[model samples]
Target chain A: MMLIDTLAQGLLLGGLYALFAAGLSLVFGIIRLVNLAHGDLIILGAYLILTVTTITGLHPFVAVLLAASLMFGLGWLLQTHLLNRVLGADILPPLLVTFGLSVVIQNGLLSGFTADSRKLAAGAIEAQSVDLAVVTLGVMPLLTFASAVAVIFALNRLFYRTALGRAFRATSDDAVTAELMGIGPQRIFAGATGIALAVATIAALYLGTRANFDPSIGPARLLYAFEAVIIGGLGSLWGTLGGGIVIGMAQALGASVNPERQILSGHVAFVVVLLLRPRGLFPRASD
Target chain B: MTPSRPLGLIAAFAALAVLYALPAIAPRALVQDLFGVLTLLVLALNWNTLAGFAGLVSVGQQAFVGIGAYAMFAAIILMDLNPLVGVLIGGLAAAAFALPMAFFAFRLNGAYFAIGTWVVADIARLGISQWKALGGGTGTSLPKGTAKDMAFVDRIKAALDVSSAAAADALTYWLMLTLAVAMLVAGHVFLRSRMGLGLQAIRDNETAARSVGVDPVRLKALVFLLTAFGTGLCGALAFIQITRVTPDAAFSVIDWTAFVIFITVIGGIGTLPGPIVGAVIFYALQRLLADYGTIYLIVLGCLGIAVMLFARRGLWGVFTGRTGIDLLPLTHRPPKSAAPQPQASRRTA
Candidate 1:
């Protein structure tokens, strides 16, 4: 019964990881560019929410939409103007460019926010809980998990069932061929980055409500998100969720024995997965 | 005709001599700060070797830096070794650890490869936080007695303590400068060798390079180890200068690695002087805008985006490609008469 509770909690925690990894997975899947700034951008979204809430006195839910929309615009412009230029066969340019962006974002936040930690006010919903036959779970955690599932489902549907998704996959497979198909690679890339920022906004919503965050915490978040993406396998949304669960489980179990080991446990699980299955647990057939 | 690449060498030496002589004429604080900046330059150069030339984008270089620092601390505190020797010992310790890590991290490609490096770093942080001898979360300081001994010996038994700080600072600056030059030269030589060519070939196209008999795996692994070694050395050097080491200080991804990435990007990747250019620019920025805090970060982000968009080849590449300035002589040029511009253009198109 205790083990079941641990597993349940771990699975719920995995939902957050999945949320973090989804944006990263999408961006990497489409452009093969690992946005080192992804985690920082999520934190920036959280700050945006905090700003909206403080200014308008709106509910957190409404603030999220505002933040998401703002971030989406930022992402679109960034890709259209900046990142599109560096997308190429050589990986160094993208990595170096993103790495530089990460620094700029972190420092920008520090200067703007004064390095003080902030949290989103979620009211009663934060403490609400649901009890199962064997264990109890937080309502927020459950919602997070459900959101992860919905996101993966929606993304899958979009990728396979929509024209935009086809463009994304086609561009991923062969940018030149997609260009020949009259699909503007630049526009597709901008759309992809915008979508990624939307996902980042979702991750930021949970992240702000879940814990107190300062400007400096983004790199660690990026590390965890990256690990989850790698563990789940690149280019698979459901696989990313699975990878998140593995990490969340490892962290929770490690915390159960020793609180300090929580972060370490997630990292350990990632290494173990890498050693045993270098291609990840569910790598795409084509990849 | 063989190009006049040696002119670049003369210019570099002249620059180095000027930098080395700044301590004689500049303010004391500025001289000390230059020493600090030079240490950062060492790290930037090391990272450029792996990521720039070899095409391995690692986000977790702090792992080796932390390991090297801890090793330096242990060597000085436990074995009672000289601080200078401790830096070398720290580097060796990092290299020893990196060998096994490379075996595992080398298996993944692209994004996976990058994440694999961070995983190793996180694991190292966890282990360090648990170990009691290493001071766990509280962190440990270098023995004051050792520092005092080194200082006193170098002071020639001065009548007062005035010579102590100066001697210690000068020794550290000279040691750091020597090591930085040595590593830069070593890196330059390595990149010019057959192994370096193999690494560059792999970066261009792994499959194509493999088809051409260049062993991609071996080259990647070798570059990874080389990067680890240089990082370890820089970590140890930094540790000695500070006279203390902490898990957070050693492992904090922000202090050194991010700056290097910024430097490499701003300077130019795949060019020898790029990292050096980047270091100078970053140090200048930090000095000028240290008070702006978050605004500085926003500016950095904006600048990064700007650089990526406007100069895809980075500051050095864009400026030099257009102006034909070879400060470090990393590129070769065909004779003006023999330059086949049309053929190159056709191939690219």
Candidate 2:
């Protein structure tokens, strides 16, 4: 029973990891750019929410909505103005640019928010839990897990069922061909980044509500999300969830054995997965 | 071609003389600052070799740095080795660690490869932090007598007529100076060699180079091992100067990798004098903006971005472009009298 409870909790934690990785996977899938500033962007989303809630005195959820739309616009502008300019045959520029962006965001946040850890106030919902027959799960964790599933589902539907999704797929396959087909790859990329940021905002909502966060925490979060993305296979949404769960379980199990081993164990699992399957569990066939 | 031998030799000797005499004329704090600058110069050179020359942009150089530091500590604390020897041991240990890391990391290409190194580095940090003998996550310091008993430390103290701490500082400065000079000389020589030519060829066009008989993997591995060894030595020297070692400090990406990348990029990567120029500018900035904290980092980030986007060739590149001066002369050019030749003919020549 205790083992089940632990596993269940880990699964829920995986949900949050999945949320963190979803946007990363989406951007990488559409455009082969890996945003090294991804973790910082997530933190930026959280801080945006914090600022919104503090000023407007709105509920955290409502603040998240406002923050998400703001982030979407920021993401659109960033991609259109900055990232688009750097995109090309050379992979180094995007990586270096994103790394620089990461630094800028981190230090910017540090200057703005200081180093003090901050968390969103969810009131009674923070304390609420559902008692399953085998285990008790926190309401927040459950919501986070459900949201992750819903996000993946929505992303999947968008990819397969929508014209924008077709544009994304067309652009991913061949940018020149997509352009010739009258699909503006630039605008598509900007839209994709905006959506990715929206997803990142959702991830931020859980991250800020579930735990204390500061500016420096972004890189570590990036590491975890990267691990998940790698383990699940790059560009696969469902696989990302699986990857997150694997890491989450490893951390939970490591914690059960020894508290200090929790984080290390997740990294170990990632390395192990990498060694055994260099291409990850579900590499895109096209790739 | 002009026989540049005498001029080069005289310049080298003059530089050495100035470095050797810096302790006498410069303030103690200035010597310490130079020590930091020299250490960074070594890191930038090694990183430039790997990323700039070999076309392998690794963001996880902290893996080697952390390992080198921890190995030095382990050597001193566990093996009872002299701290001087521990520095060498630290380097060897880092080189050893690089092999397995390369085996895995080399499998991935581009961005995956970059993050692969970071993941391995993160794992290395976590693993090192678990060793209780080394103060676990908190980290450990050098033994009480180790710093005082460092080889040549006593001689330095007596000769310099300074306190033991200051003597230690001077010794560290001299060591770093020697290392930095050695790295520059070695890097210059290597880039001028046949192997270096092959490495550059591979960097330019991997498939074409492979077709022409250059083994890309072998060349990359050699560069990787060499840089790791050098980076390890720098890490050991840096931590020794601090006289304290922590996993976090040892494995700091910002200090070891990010700043080094910025320096290399801003100074003009893939050139001998570029890192030198970059390191100087970086040192100047650090000294000027040390008080600003995050604002300083933000500025650095902005500068790095600007360099990456607008000035990819960096400061040295811009200077070289306008002046047509090749300071280190890594490239060979035929006299103007010679007619233009085909690529094949040029290679044969």
Clashes of 1: 9
Please write out the lDDT profile of model 2 over residues B1-349, one tens digit for every residue.
2245467668868978998888877889989888888988899999999988998889999999899888989998999998889899989999999999999889778887888788889889989888899998899998876777888888988987888887888888888898988998899889878899899888778889999999989989999999999999889888888878888999998989888988888898877788988988998899899998878788888888888788777888877676555567576666556846522211210
- Fnat of each prediction, in sequence: 0.75, 0.75
Q: Could you give candidate 1's per-residue lDDT for residues A1-287 as a string of tens digits?
A: 87889889999999999999898899989988888888889999999999999999987778999899999999999898778888876666677667778877787787678788899999999999988878999998998899889988998999889999999999989999999999998999899899889988988888899889898888788888888888888888889999999999998998988999999988889888988987789999355
Q: What DockQ does each listed candidate score?
A: 0.58, 0.80
Span of 10 residues, lowest total lDDT, candidate 2 chain B: B340-349
Q: List the residue pairs that clash in candidate 1.
A: A104-B301, A107-B297, A108-B297, A108-B298, A110-B294, A111-B293, A111-B294, A111-B295, A112-B294
Q: What's the distance in Å from true for residue A134, model 1?
A: 0.9
lDDT of 1 by residue, B1-349 (tens): 1244477667778988987766445555776898888888888888888787777778778899999999888888878888778888888888888888888887777655676787788688778888788799888888765655664445532532345565566667767788789888898788767778678777777788899899977787777887788889888887777887778889877676766667777777677778787778877788788896555545555666677667756777776666655555543355678975633311100
In order, what lDDT does every prediction score?
A: 0.80, 0.88
- Measured by DockQ, the strongest candidate is 2
Candidate 2 chain B TM? 0.92
- TM-scores of the models, in the given order? 0.92, 0.96
